[model samples]
Target: MTEAAFIDIDWAGRPVRIEYQWIARDRAAAPLIVFLHEGLGSVAMWKDFPQRLCIATGCRGLVYSRPGYGRSTPRAAEEAWGLDFMHRQAQEVLPALLEALGIDATRDKPWLLGHSDGASIALLYAASYPQRIAGAIVLAPHILVEDLSVSSIEKVRAAYLETDLRQRLARHHDDPDSAFWGWNDIWLKPAFRHWSIEAEISAIRCPLLAVQGLDDEYGTLAQIHGIARRAAQTELFELADCGHSPHRDQPERLITAITAFIQQQPHGDKP
Candidate 1:
């Protein structure tokens, strides 16, 4: 394990600072697994899942925060994220962060392990840069924001406003409002109700594993089913009694599934 490093990179004509933690089992050579966080996720929010998975697979791991969440710069107060925010993450932020860290997208097509919004981001990234991804494990991903998603988001807003949900989330983000409002406002918006990325998902060529919790409140099983519908090389896993966060809900199962998925992919380095 190494200490976290903070780096500054130019993103979309502005300077954006990023904090990342990298782990290498073989300093001389190792494949990479890039971990993307969920809607309200930060590097810290991932807990020890990245390390566990990397150790299990004997691969290097890259865990970092998006622009608006975690230690990264806060989103401009006036900047309202568009429906394509996830696309921007896949197209812009992810590529910028990888380049800044000297992770070659072409030479080392890293495995992607993403949760929730991060899972959607992974799907979009694979579609945009299919050749750059080896394999992917997406937990609680959303290809289309459904009525269930909106209804759940509405409940989240109410919880944040009426309960101590904000205080709980404050522990994970430097600016809780930046993380909470950015996700909540967008998910609860009327226009966002129709937000869907199924068209883009069709372009993904890498092996994919889509996992969802049976008890997921934010989304339904349809999310993973939709991914399987588009991508030919896709597998689905529905964990019983699990919720939105599969890694947290069933760490052992999540790890096992990912390890198996990577081992099944010919391109990924063996454990």
Candidate 2:
């Protein structure tokens, strides 16, 4: 893997330094795959999966760490993300980053590959800007708040407080508290229990591939099922014996499915 480069973008009236890297940049004309990391994830957290996937499909890949996660900006100590946090990320931060990088999504129409909260963001982006996305492949995305999801987050909070979870996250984030508490506090808020994107996602017209792990502890299969129900262009993949992080637990299968799905799309721009 290559070291990340930094770029600053104006987001929410503040300059945010984004950490990003381009994998297989030599394939300039090939389809672009933009990677969105999970809620607690960062650029380093993705390891080499994006590179491997890009190589497999012979496409260029862009991977980045969201603000407050990797070497990017950290959240203010008193800051607490709202229920609309993901929406802002999809609608504001992402577009700003793309513009800063001179990526005209309107023309390039990159494919989005996302996991967990990142997947949710991808869905939101594709829905909001249908013309900008070639397609999307999401893994273990949360479209709505479920008791199971809340419970799992609750457990993770305990682990963060008591176990080595903080240490583990520190390896990925410069300020682990920024990543953990930002995600943790929001999901655990009582008002967030009603948070749902099922209706908003109905606007997505681009092709979609929603993947989930059967044994995922964070959420149930209904997440992807609900997506497919809402978007007629959606294809579903349920992997058995896998957990919340399919990219980590089942990378080969996930990559294969994603490659096939993208390559099979109309005007998929096969290399």
Candidate 3:
């Protein structure tokens, strides 16, 4: 079982609350797996998948909602996220959060399991601090912007404006507009069209498992394939009959793949 908790940290010179949960914390020597959610995802949105994966792999799990999502601090109405928002999360917030929780990445070398936008953040973090990560398992990561991604984002903008998407998202977020627009506006910005981490990702020295759904409307297989071309230890798994979110659509298969991947790593010895 997992239990939710909150912690306060100074971000941009102001105090901010971050919501997180831990699974299998009693296994002190077990490998750590940190869960990073998608753009619209909150801590609650992950449901029981993280707990299940932690138990299956005999690893400790840490799942958290980024700022502006779930019970964490909401994005102010006037606060427009910049093109490098995801970069900031990886370069700044993640490290800060881990430090606040007394998680010494240099010692623990946690594995990052991230989805969608979170997957992209994981890649950035691994590239920036390769030695601190044991490995990374990214699902539906974007190495570069694509026409398909832009088109899907446009459709999402339409849905949020004309449909019940806002109301639905409200169930997970304390301030739905803060979460929605913070992600939406940034992606749709014309300046963001050139956003690409392809060159930077080449610096990632840790083992990587990049998974993509064949039917993912937001991105193409090129996303994960691109990682393999640059990151030498990269493995790719393209799932059939799945969409953007594999954890929800194919939990069993995802779990099995991740378990096997982790087991293959040199430091993956069971506790």
Candidate 4:
């Protein structure tokens, strides 16, 4: 396997340069898999999971940061994210990234494998552009904000400020606070209480897989269950002794489920 290039590509009407780690299996005909990271996630944070999955599935892969993570540009200090921050990611940033890389959403729909907030963004993207996505693997996605979420975020704030969480996060980000607070602030805001996307779940026509951890502290099982309720074809998986980050905590199980889902999904034009 050749090393993935840590290159740059413009996005979102800005000089947004992202790390495009890619590998082409067969230039003529291999499906693409785009990995969307969590809110505080970055290209480096994904470690080698993307590479492993790409190898396991025999597919080409692209994994990059969303503006304010990894080798991408940092978020502006004064730039407070709106309630529609996640929506902006789905509707704007993602498409731009794909276009910059010459990946046609219309002709060659890519499989989206997103984690946490990234998972929610994938859901939003799939629902809004039903015809542009092949299928999605959403892990620990939030359909609606819950009190447990707020509480867990608050705990994260404390951990970042008082413990080794900052040091740990430093390894993956140029500016850890930029990634941490940007996600934590918006999620913990009082005005963000009404943030919900359950209404859009019904609009997602793609085959879906939603996974959650039984010991997830940020949300209840309702997150995945709600998605299943909306999409009848959706399958759910719950891993015990796992927390919020399933990809990190339970990588083997996560990869197994995703690989199986992709293999079983009938490949054809998007619905």
Candidate 5:
């Protein structure tokens, strides 16, 4: 079973509400696995994937919506996100959320599972707080801006304007425009083309699993390959038929890989 809850925290000098859910709460001593959603994803958008993963691994799971998505606080329409938006989330928002929830990573040492933009944020967080994370499993993470990413985002922009993208996204986000533009505009920015975290990832010391689809339109294998080059401990998985979102495209395979990876870790034993 999953329990949904909210925490009020301060971000950028304003009170923001974060919606989060806990899966497998009965497993108090089990390792914690935090799920970071995609750019346009929310807690509700993840559906039952997090819960299913936690149940399979005998671990506790935490899934949450970022400040500007899902049922959480929406971004101001006029406010523009900077090139370092993902960096800010990893360095500032994540730490605050953990503290507010009384989760001491130094003591518990949670593992992170992030997809798409969330995966990039996970990489940044792991790099910044190397000792706090047990390990990280990132799916379709972007280490640097690629032409493919920008081009795909451009297509999404067109869809949002000419298609039903906004309407479909509204089913998941409280303010679909806030969620869509915040991610789209930042990625499409001219300055953002230079955004890269390859150097910083070298600081990570924990085990890492970087998975990407062979057919991912937003990024190429270079994303995970780059992580392996900088972080020697990284393991890469390239799924042939999968796309950007592996959980949705290849859920069973992803679960199997994740379970085996977690069990192989030094702290793998189930509590």
Candidate 6:
């Protein structure tokens, strides 16, 4: 396992310790792709995907576990996330991490590769800070909440309460409850049904690739389709025989598609 490093940043009037690792850091001048994990994911959960993708794309990779996940600062027991959680991560947490690490977004304009909730954050970041990102490739991104998504979340919640889900997540998160509930409780909230980023994503000015799994139980094809409709820069890809986690489900194909997409960038590296 790659040794992870920690950086502390103050967010929401509290100090947060973020755990991160650099892949192929020796590629000094290569363009960077920052890897954002899924809601329940941590740098540990991402495993070798970041390294594999970076190798194929010849891009340096930054993989980090957000607050409340992995070995980072866990969420307070009483803390509950709001509808704007994703937005807060995009606007505050991400930028803070970059600044603390001395990564000047104005110069590097790194690309973002995010999964699930992280994918939504990537889209929000690209939209909110157009000049700070060169492009984004989102896997199983959710633009708006669907009944299917709520239903799946409900099931996962039950499994967390009834099954070994907690024990399983223990391998990834320092406190699985902190990772699971923070994501679950918010998504299942009644008012959360109205959560949507359709308008905000229209402001995205960077290269965008929004991908969805045809068989994703948490969402539908509408997710990427909707992004393409709202964001002119977005390109949509729907993979067959895949579920929510494409990086795990269809890594080779996903990697191939992603490499092709990034290589298409004017200054992106080629295979």
Q: List RMSD in Å for every model shown.
A: 1.3, 0.9, 0.8, 2.6, 0.9, 1.1
Pairs of colliding residues, candidate 3: none
Looking at model 1, the pairs that clash are: none
- Model 5 Cα lDDT, one tens digit per residue, 125-188: 9999988999999999999999999999999999999999999999988899999999999989
Q: Can you write out model 1's per-residue Cα lDDT over 1-271, one digit (the tens) per residue?
A: 5667788888889999887888773543677889999999998888888999888877889899898888888887877889999999999999988898777889878888899999999999999998888878899999998888888888888999999988888787778888889888888888987889999999999889999999999898888998888897899999997999999999998888888878767756554
Q: Candidate 1 lDDT (Cα, whole model)?
A: 0.87
Q: Cα miss at 4, model 2 (Å)?
A: 0.5
Candidate 1: segments with Cα more than 4 A from true spot: 25-28
Over the stretch 1-271, how does candidate 3's per-residue lDDT look in tens digits?
A: 5678999988888989999999988898999999999999989999999999998899999999999999899999999999899899999889999999999999999999999999999999999998899999999998899999999999999999999999999999999999999999999999999999999998999989999999999999999989999997899998998999999889999999999999988968677
Q: What is the TM-score of each candidate against the true structure?
A: 0.96, 0.98, 0.98, 0.93, 0.98, 0.98
Local distance difference test scores for all models: 0.87, 0.92, 0.93, 0.84, 0.92, 0.93
- Looking at model 6, residue 1 earns an lDDT score of 25
Question: Better model by lDDT, 1 or 6?
Answer: 6
lDDT of 6: 0.93
CA error at residue 102 for candidate 3, angstroms: 0.6
Better of 2 and 4 by lDDT: 2
Candidate 4: which stretches are off by over 4 Å?
A: 1-13, 25-28, 268-271
Candidate 2 — which residues are off by over 4 angstroms? none
Model 5 TM: 0.98
Candidate 6 off by > 4 Å? none
Extract clashing residue pairs from model 6: none
Candidate 2 vs. truth: CA RMSD? 0.9
Q: Which residue pairs collide, candidate 4?
A: none
Model 2 / residue 82 / CA error / Å: 0.8
